[model samples]
Target: MSSRISGPGLGSRSARRAAAVTPLLLAVLLSGCSSGGSGGTKASSAPSPRTESTATATAPASPDAAAYRRWGIDKPLAAPPAPPSAKLTDGLKPGAAPKVIRRVPTSDKVVFLTFDDGAEKDPEFVKMTKDLKLPFTMFLTDDIARAGTGYGYFEQLRGEGNRNSINNHTLSHPNLRTLSADAQRREICGQQDVLEKRYGGKPPLFRPPYGNYNDATLAAAGGCGVKALLLWEATMQINDMRYAQGDQLRPGDIVLAHFRGPSELKGTTMTKMVANMLRSIERQGFTVARLEDYV
Candidate 1:
């Protein structure tokens, strides 16, 4: 037989203990449910391992990565292959008018960067090149190089390495196609003398002003000790590139740009223009190689 305990005071000690413990047990269950809900929320909000791994994989990795970022490049440029022991002259003869070269003949994924006219003298460009160890060739006109502090500025750009070569552009940047042979000789040979004296050696390369050249221009360039008449497959502007052939960059293509500043670039700095050029180059899966290396 069972008896019913109706009042709190009428219950046994064990029954009273259970009666008091039941409220605490309910409180603990509620608390655990609340905590579990919060834990689920946190787990959903946290980043997954796959997301983290993807971020790590896409980040630029190189000693100069920070420098590249500073200069507006997304990644550090690929280092060029070591220069060949025997320079590739592409069947260029020693005595005749130097062979005209629009591109180096090589299978390596490389292009040459050549800058013409020392018009803009930005000190920061020197810092950028040095910071990145970029290699390029300069074809400086005498009038522009001698103007103001341009000569010293280019000297800073030449630095202490043989990677940056100073070549002849001409005395006054006249269109060689319009000039007589004697006149062309004065333009090419005269600037040759200036560059040799100022830069410490005779330049072995020459680029005709405005990409304009004739047989007389080549003959005069050879007379002035030019070994090759360098031309361009692409010209880099402030924000875009103009290609002589297709819209794409080709292996060993020579790219032309100028030492121009905001005045000529629609208010873009020379460094920014160069950074854009590099971005274009990177998009094409190519890196800059020293033009002096293969030519």
Candidate 2:
């Protein structure tokens, strides 16, 4: 959830200098979510939240230069509307990037619970998963997903029959958007290759570090056999000492949480967050579903 994803043009003097001074930005974003069930494990150290944002920003600037020049126009491209829901597919075609899985269930009240950047699996989280029987989506990073580490935790989740998945968050958690074409391929495809080998199945989905991406970022993701660009519709943030996700949670909302920072991990401690999230969902009279099942 909170890891760095490197991209090109992010290593220059200006970028490095900016990076050094960018901690303040993280402080601003993380300070509010540092405690309670709201923080969770994906809540990496404060100021390091740039992990995903920096990577997603690596795309070549002036993406529409040629097109604009052709039309003798010079203005920023409009923000594209949300993509429609679609089925997941495998393999990459030339110039194709990952397609956005806008929301798993557009009509159901069910919520897709997702955790990112699992530093390690916590027994507490696992227990809660078993107790609640909540299905979740884990966007795994290479560090904890490796053999002899958090791998067993992943297996445990599957053994418990938790409706969840392990998708690529990138091998080193570098922001693929910031990397060069080669680096993007390395981060995207490289992680896919590793997860396939280590996890026994490659993920068909990807989440750019920090939910940040542009046209080029999406293209790169698609080129690597990633079909779905996963993003959240809502986030649980601290309201005083408790976590809140809007006035009333709804059906079909993708709620984001974390399990890779100072306070929590996937196995146990992270369960508190999931428990709270599940309770919220139940309160809304909606059930939790596997992202794959719905998407």
Clashing pairs in 1: none
Alpha-carbon error at 267 in model 1, in Å?
Answer: 0.9
Count backbone overlaps in model 2: 35
Best by TM-score: 1
**TM-score for candidate 1:** 0.76
lDDT of 2 by residue, 168-259 (tens): 77766664556777777777788788777765556766776655555666666676666566666556432211223446655566666655
- Which 10 consecutive residues of model 1 have the lowest summed lDDT? 35-44
lDDT of 1 by residue, 158-270 (tens): 64434577888888877677789899999999998887776566787787776666677767877777766776667776676766566888888888777766654567898
Cα error, candidate 2, residue 214 (Å): 2.5
Clashing pairs counted in every model: 0, 35
Query: Best-fitting candidate, measured by lDDT?
Result: 1
